[model samples]
Target: MYVCPEGHMAYKKARSLQKNSIKNEKLIFFFDVEKCKCCPLEGICHKIGTKSKTYTLTIKSNLHQEQLDFENSDAFREKSRMRYRIEQKNSELKNRYGLKKSMSNGLFGMTIQSASTVFIANMRKIIREIEKKGA
Candidate 1:
């Protein structure tokens, strides 16, 4: 769930080395930065005046394959489920609060519009619960 600044992502191919370690069960993670520099979207990630982008990830945990598979098997599916809720909220904000057509210009105005939409959505959910109780 992390966005790399350098736009490069590397998955290590050193599984054998990690297996030879003391634990003999390890998750070897590699971070290769050079690959990112040569990417197609390098311009967007590496712009002038911007600090050097770095994509660093480390994972050296020792766990059995079955254990790791059990833990991470449904991770991608869970992320997809979470995305649906976020997208629904964004659509609601655009349709109900006019987020697509800003009422005022500038970054500050846009911030307020987004904030208010979130607040309104939460309030509406709470009010519905209260009304159900009263009825």
Candidate 2:
């Protein structure tokens, strides 16, 4: 079971199907049209008279749905808070360490530049830790 991003209850999983020359079959999930009709936020939730009553999600494998389900669990919610700290680190690298734009042209030069930037960032973190410890 998957809930929509807007918190709508999507209760059923439809079968997988491949329509054309697509390589992978798509996994579909659905919400009852009757529920949508009765919902107070119907206009905001879904457009009235839409042809389809289902929400379609494409999955790479059976494990993909399982992964999504795990992500929705309470334990995952607790762990996901750390993602914001990681994002802040990335933002610092881009803004403070000048990783937002490549200084060198060509793939090899870009690789070198990125490596150097990351090394410098790591060194800065080490220096800060040492300073904090006063040793």
| Angstrom error at residue 19, model 1 | 41
- Model 2: per-residue Cα lDDT over 19-82, one tens digit each: 6644556667788777777777777767898755677666566676688889899999998888
Instruction: Give per-model CA RMSD.
Output: 16.2, 8.2
The local distance difference test score of model 1 is 0.64
- Per-candidate TM-scores read 0.42, 0.45
Ten consecutive residues with minimal summed lDDT in candidate 2?
A: 18-27
Error of 2 at 51 (Å): 13
lDDT of 1 by residue, 1-135 (tens): 344555445444344344446555333445444665566666665563444443333554545656667657788668767998999988987888677787788999988888887898889999999999999
For candidate 2, give the lDDT. Answer: 0.80
Clash totals, every prediction: 0, 0
